[model samples]
Target: MEIRVLGIGCARCNELEKRVKDALAELGIAANVEHVTDLKEIAALGVLMTPGLVIDGKVASQGKVPSKDELKKLLGGGK
Candidate 1:
């Protein structure tokens, strides 16, 4: 799967990346995780806020870092 974490190298952005990795590890899923730091790219993805989470090219969450449990859901484990 393809996952993108959009941010401008902020703490929250880094934390979100870590959470994404942790969630992926817990779920035993291998994904190509990328960190998007370009403003243009992030905007093109339609994320208006930092710490955006994009799963398989679709916007999943934005503006704040989500908990690992929440990430598990976002990663397709739950509703």
Candidate 2:
């Protein structure tokens, strides 16, 4: 799966990326996690938030870092 973390390299953005990786690892799922720091790209996603999580090209969460449990749920829990 393509997991994109959109942010301008802030603390929250880094945290979100790490959490996403942990969640995917816990679920035994291999995913490509990318950090998008480009403003144009982030803006194209229509997110006005600094930290955004995009899973499979769809915006999953924005503005804050979600817990690993929440990320697992957002990823569909391997189902």
RMSD of each: 1.9, 1.4
After TM-score superposition, what is the CA distance of residue 58 in candidate 1 from its true location, in Å?
0.6
The lDDT of model 2 is: 0.89
Error of 1 at 55 (Å): 0.2
- Off-target runs (Cα >4 Å) in candidate 1 are 77-79
Estimate, for each residue in 1-79, the C-alpha lDDT of model 2 and write its tens digit.
8889999989999999999899888888888899999999999999899899888878989998888889999986434
- Poorest lDDT segment (10 consecutive residues) of candidate 2: 70-79
User: In order, how many clashes per candidate?
Assistant: 0, 0
Q: Residues 1-79, candidate 1, lDDT per residue (tens digit)?
A: 8999999999999999999999999899989899999999999988999999999878999999999999999996422
Query: Any idea what lDDT model 1 has?
Result: 0.91
> How does each model score on lDDT?
0.91, 0.89
Best-matching candidate per lDDT:
1
